[model samples]
Target: MGIVRLIDRQGNRHELQALEGWRVMEILRDWGMFVPPRCGGSGQCGMCHVKVAEDWSGKVLPPGELEAKVLPLLPGRGETSRLSCQILWSETLDGLTVALP
Candidate 1:
């Protein structure tokens, strides 16, 4: 299991273990985090957007067609903008931080 920290909009931090093969959004939603997993996390909606910290932002990302479409619609589109629903857990991301904007 990998532990990932999610800093919510109000700056509250919640630590959770990323279930194997589960997207960050799903983990958050399962843990009762505020992320809206609308569009079934298909990347059709930008509801699952999360901001990766400077360090983790540069890491390799999960790829998908819907992920590409949703990234541009997020609040702060950046080189690291990602739909949480698109990200899959891996060992390298155990201590990753994601800020919910």
Candidate 2:
């Protein structure tokens, strides 16, 4: 188990219990957060966008090929933008922080 910190659009912070092997999108969705159903965790749709905290950007691996292509076209993409569906939760990701765009 691990903790993942999430910041809503309104800047409210939330701490979630993250299970290993689950996708970040799944964690958010299961916690009642608004994750779009576009690609349904397939990493094809960019709707599950998140801006990784600058300090945490290097912690998570780079986006996959499909996520790489889609992220660039997203509206609020930042230098640390990522597709949540492409991120698999794990012990190493404990304390990871991301903000919804």
Candidate 3:
């Protein structure tokens, strides 16, 4: 398991216990963190957008093809922008922090 931190657009912070192999979006939505997951973790809807914390940006895996295609269209897309549904929880992601966009 891992501890994932989510910061909302309003600057509110929420911490959740994330299980291995679970998607970040799943954890956030299950914990009522405000992620819509409109596409049910299918990577189609961009409502699960989150920005990796600058300090931990390199810890998470890079975006795959679908994410690459969808992310750019969202406002404030940047090096840290990522779809929460596409992020898999693992030991490497322990203590990961992200901000809702």
Candidate 4:
């Protein structure tokens, strides 16, 4: 298991235990966080947008072609924007931090 620190829209911080091999969106949703992954984990919807902490951005894999295309269309996206549904969690991501937009 790894730790994912999530910052909600309200600016509240939540430390969640992440299971390896799970999508970040799944971990957030399972913890009762508000990531409306309308397209499930397919990267078709930009609803699960999150801004990864700058320092941690390089730690995760880059978005795939489909995700890259969709990310730019999302509102409030930034340089480190990513779809939680497209991010696969792993032990190497322990302590990864992201903020909900």
Query: Quick one: best lDDT, which candidate?
Result: 4
Prediction 2 TM-score vs. true: 0.96
Q: Per-residue alpha-carbon lDDT of model 2 for 2-100, expressed as tens digits?
A: 998999999999999999999999999999888465879898878789999999999999987888889889998899999999899899999999999
Per-residue lDDT of candidate 1, residues 11-98 (tens digit): 9988998867787888888888864766887778888888887889767475577677667767777767788878777887888898
Candidate 4 residue-wise lDDT, 1-101, digit = tens: 88999999999999999999999999899999984677877999888899999999999999999999998899998999999998899989999999999
With candidate 2 superimposed using the best TM-score fit, by how many Å does residue 78's alpha carbon deviate from the native?
Answer: 0.2
Clashing pairs in 1: none
All candidates: TM-score: 0.86, 0.96, 0.93, 0.96
| RMSD list, candidates in order | 1.7, 0.8, 1.1, 0.8
Prediction 1 global C-alpha lDDT: 0.79
Per-residue error (Å), model 1, residue 14? 1.6
Give the 10-residue window scoring lowest on summed lDDT in candidate 2: 32-41
Off by over 4 Å in 1: none
The predicted structure with the larger TM-score, 1 or 2, is 2
Cα-based lDDT at residue 77, candidate 3: 84
Deviation from native of the Cα of residue 72 in model 2, angstroms: 1.0
lDDT of each: 0.79, 0.91, 0.90, 0.92
lDDT of 3 by residue, 1-101 (tens): 77999898899888899999999999998898874777998898888999999998888888999989999899988789999999999988999999987
